[model samples]
Target: MSTRITGTSHLKSENVNVWFGERHVLKDVNITFPANQVTALIGPSGCGKSTFLRTLNRMHELIPGAGFAGKILLDGTDIYDPQMDPVNVRLNIGMVFQKPNPFPTMSIKDNVLSGLRLSGRKTDDASGLLESSLRRASIWNEVKDRLGDAALSLSGGQQQRLCIARALAMNPEVLLMDEPCSALDPGSTRRIEETIVELSESMTIVIVTHNMQQAQRVADETAFFLAEDGNPGGVVEFGNTEDVFNRPVDGRTNDYVNGHFG
Candidate 1:
């Protein structure tokens, strides 16, 4: 039987498991991302951190042989319900990748609106959304005059923010990010971290990060994932960020937060 989650959760995973062909990647991963808060997933590479992130909005199914069991609920509704459309799921829950992935051929303005246009969503105020989204992503001042410039023309950090702006243009209720600052310089990383904190005021955010400091700085709550001795990945411990980092209940979590081992 599926467990019922209590409290004011914006997004939640209940007994979620994921597989790629014959290999199980995620095992019974359960998490509740509270509304307007940032929840970070931290773990070593190959521990299914990214895999679990993709499962949030059914993005995992895009891969060949990728499958998952259990429910991913958004506001008490199972997004994986047969009656729900995947396109709408994605539209409501936007995602930004690890690397900056702006459309190489599209202009800055066009890139931000690309989601809406491709989704056949007509915005009465495209110009207003373009500015507001860029502003929210913290890149409006940098690229305001250059809205006509190619998205790739911006720096690595700028590109990532542009990608963020693109996601924001959809007005999603929740945002999923996969190590968005991993590729940028420290300065850019700091800026992105600040943006993450700011965005949390308006929407639920779930992020995967290898950087413990980043998680501590931005996440209100944190979950640590681990896959040891040929086992599928699962949450070792989860709680308020301070507790997860400073007073982790699991020894493994303690080691991870203290940099003893990944």
Candidate 2:
């Protein structure tokens, strides 16, 4: 199976500030994610990179006391608008978490089709969609023969790809990954990185990664965030990946990316 390029869109953030019950986690942030490209958010552990990633599709608000002020726009439309349902936003922006989390009880085939079922979408060609999605995730060849097997039966890397396949089944315009390769081994990480690069040709992608090298390898653009002196997290620098890594304008960005400090 070859890569399937589908939904694509430009995502932008404007004056975005987030608070978790009065504790500000993210200060005013503004960034733009070009269509069919991968943007990486790189920072130290408590810098709120993952928090900002969740805000792209309104997932940040799922936290009990979380609140944010600002606009997250998809194709110029504010996704946080009261009239814009979060479910719809999520449908267009799929997410994969830090760990591989396939539904243990569901078969590999069912796992790929789970999104369609959850979204209440009906399609006559479920089998085709499953195959294409798995292929797009770069895992179809590995699991083609065991579609009826339980999802947990696959290896860790395969499970992660399966999750990506499931997300692709929704035909999301953007894909948000939060340290999707953090728990994987070197080989698995490389495969996931390859999948990310391949997927970017068809969808907008934003990833939160602590590894500067990984960011340099997979990201087209990079944003550096920091939370210093007890201040809230915010982007310190942003630019093309190569420039951000090799010729950062901000001293802090240089320090972080060069292993001097984080």
Candidate 3:
């Protein structure tokens, strides 16, 4: 099986499949996440959008019985290789989840620095890194004078932005976000959307959302997944965002975009 896609590709999965014990969760998924751009994955509930995101950074293995076969490539390197460290893969491809899960015990500054410590990196450069990361997340000035405060003390939006800042402090080449806007208010959601668009100029982004309007707002490319038989998931359609939403090649895609199905 082909393991990598070269020529400016930031990430890819070739014939990837996932199973949880006897039940398959994902089937034969192949796609490329481009460098310095945002690729949105959208589908109805239980369609494996989040599973695909976890696979990108190798988080599917967090489940005890979960298993998968296929190569996940980051910058043309095989992330699933037997000799590769999953931790290293995750370090380079950071992730932000739907919930704002900053460490309750950590100071905001410490929250941003924690990943570096876990990855065994020095913290000397953190001041500048933290400043830049929080700035990129659009939360710098709001929390600048209170960096030592507990991350959990922030409002829901601030906590989420802090999580984004934590991810950014890693200097990741790609960022995977799973329904990041789901729990946020419109104003905060808009700021995060703007951040995604801006960060796309420097880092490859893969976001999974059920929100069609969100997909249209920021995605340069979009992939639609379908859960056939209410079981295993598969890619039903994929193409440029404009075409996927406006001139889909598949009837199911057209129906989904037109709000005919989940």
Candidate 4:
């Protein structure tokens, strides 16, 4: 398969705050995701990292009573504009969840092409798209011979890559991953990390992970979120990964990175 790079776009969150009905989950979160780079959101559990990520593609609104304030811009256009369709926002910024979730009954090829079919996109070169997407996800060689096999036949790591392939097939400009390797074994985690690094060369990626080491390995920039004293979550530090890890301005950030506390 030829090396095909997906187009990328900058994503920015400007004064973003999120709430679930009366309870605030995220507060004044501001971050910028550079095109063709990987930005990792790192923090402890329930720090609203996932919540902030969902807002990027408008997935937060899927929950009843969940809403947010402020701008989520994709390449200078606000995704939450009244005229902007959430479906289209999602199409441009695809998401992969914490677990590997391939369609159990669908063939591997069908799983990869599912996003396009759901979006009603018509393309004469679907097979070509499938090959390229799988290759981009670094799973083409493993599953190419078994394209017609059930997606569940693959191992856990392969299943996750297949899910990524499905997202890539949509030609999304940005990819959001929420603890994508949390459920996989160490070897699988390493493979997923490799895929993340490779994909970052051509797609804007924002990943939420509790694994500090993983963030250090795959992210170019890192944003550290924190929730304290029963208050809402917010970013305490944001900078290049090395700076954030080695020279954090905030004591909280330094504590978290050095395994002092989360």
Candidate 5:
């Protein structure tokens, strides 16, 4: 069974901003990701949605001078504290990208076990773990017979699910996806979208997407981000998915979704 999440605020950003050298990317934005819900972050290009996503897991630290202000909390504990290791925060918050980035050298089964082994876990039910992870990713029925095949050999859609399964194998509490469908055909995108909907039943999921229709289909809540001043981006509106889509409080949101100016 998937371990029960304690329903803590899985992710919280309090007055967070990000910078790269002289450029400020994300503005003072505060948001919380609830347990077992999917939150979609939508915006135009360079709107800082992806920047905010990277900050949630401290991925910003990898870039030179990519400093951040304010606190990001996970499970009510401050993740920005010097005492907290970024690796530990990352272990609990996994990420997927726009492109299917399966380990080119690892087999599907090995890819799933990679995180567990990397974390120094031993004496686990590897086969059962593989089964559960694959099922959670909604690709067990498709790849059950080819577990030993190289992950890179799977179709684009299958590789994406395999990436999700690999993240699940680590037993993370939150999964972050950045435009996961941007690289796929329509059929593959639908399959992955279905997989995300199912996974959100057990994990907190946050996605950065340009596809308004796709966000409507899977996200429980939607957040709209707008860039202003050519420096930092901020949230323009946020609400229940239905409310944001059908009755957005801001005209910008309605215009953007209706194919007007981004």
Candidate 6:
């Protein structure tokens, strides 16, 4: 059974498997993301944490020979259904990459509205959406006065927040982040973590992070992934954040979380 918020699931993966050509990277992974909450995916490198995050939004298929099996459900509908358009799926499930990727030539304000414009979706109030998105990202005060400046003019942390604002302008139902804070300094990471917690009040968030302290700080739930002895990665344990870190049922989970071994 999956967790439910207000009588419905937010997003979930059922027996999901992934392949890069013939190499199986992930196997039979199942996890549910409750609505209005933050879930963290934590694992060491080469454990398929990023791959699973990409799968959530159908971004995995972008690789030339990548393939996926099983269901990725959002609001009880499988996003991979043959009839579903991948573009629309992405629009509903926004993604932020490991590094901040704002368009270097675009202005800060333009970056925020780029998603809306590219999707051919018109908004009655572009300025309003821009301000709202930036505010939700906790960056409006910092960049509001420099909206016309080039996006690259901002610092690395600011660029990440701007990228987040760009995704927010689309008003996605679920947000997927892959190591969103790995490249930032401590102060910037703190601000981004704050933003993550605040965003969870309105929309579901699933983040992939290697920072154990970060996962415990912002996630309501955590799922630990591992691949041992040259095997494919899969969920070793999943549960509330505190439990997963402090009282995991699987000894492997305990070992990984306790710094015994990854």
The list of candidate 5 runs beyond 4 A from truth reads 1-9
Pairs of residues at least 3 apart in sequence or in different chains that clash in candidate 3 = none
Displacement of the residue 168 alpha carbon in candidate 6, Å: 0.5
Q: Which should have the higher TM-score, number 3 or number 5?
A: 3
- The regions of model 6 sitting more than 4 angstroms off are 1-9
Report backbone clashes per prediction.
0, 0, 0, 0, 0, 0
After superposition on all CA atoms, what RMSD does each candidate show versus the true structure?
3.9, 3.7, 3.3, 3.6, 2.6, 3.8
Model 4 residue runs over 4 Å out of place are 1-8
TM per candidate comes to 0.96, 0.96, 0.95, 0.96, 0.94, 0.96
> Candidate 5 residues 146-170, lDDT tens each?
9999888899988998988999998
Model 6 clash pairs are none
Model 4, span 60-93: residue lDDT tens:
9999999789999887889898978788888889
lDDT winner, 2 or 5: 2
lDDT of 3 by residue, 137-226 (tens): 999999999999999889898899899999999878889999999999999899999999998988899999988999999999999999
Better of 1 and 5 by lDDT: 1
> What is the TM-score of candidate 5?
0.94
Which model, 3 or 6, shows the larger lDDT? 6
The model with the greater TM-score, 1 or 3, is 1
Please report, as a residue range, the 10-residue window in candidate 5 with the lowest summed lDDT: 1-10
Better candidate number, 2 or 3, judged by lDDT: 2
lDDT string, candidate 2, 57-139, tens digits = 88898899998999998888888888787888888899999999999889999999998788777789999999999999999
Instruction: Give candidate 1 regions above 4 Å deviation.
Output: 1-9
Candidate lDDT values, in order: 0.92, 0.92, 0.89, 0.92, 0.87, 0.92
Model 2, position 212: C-alpha lDDT score: 83
lDDT by residue (1-262, candidate 6, tens digit) is 1222132337999999999999899999999999989999999899998999999999899998998999998888888989788888888889998999999879999999999778878899999999999999999999999999999999999999999999999888899999999999999999999999999998899999999999999999999999887788999999999999989999989889999876
Name the TM-score of candidate 1.
0.96
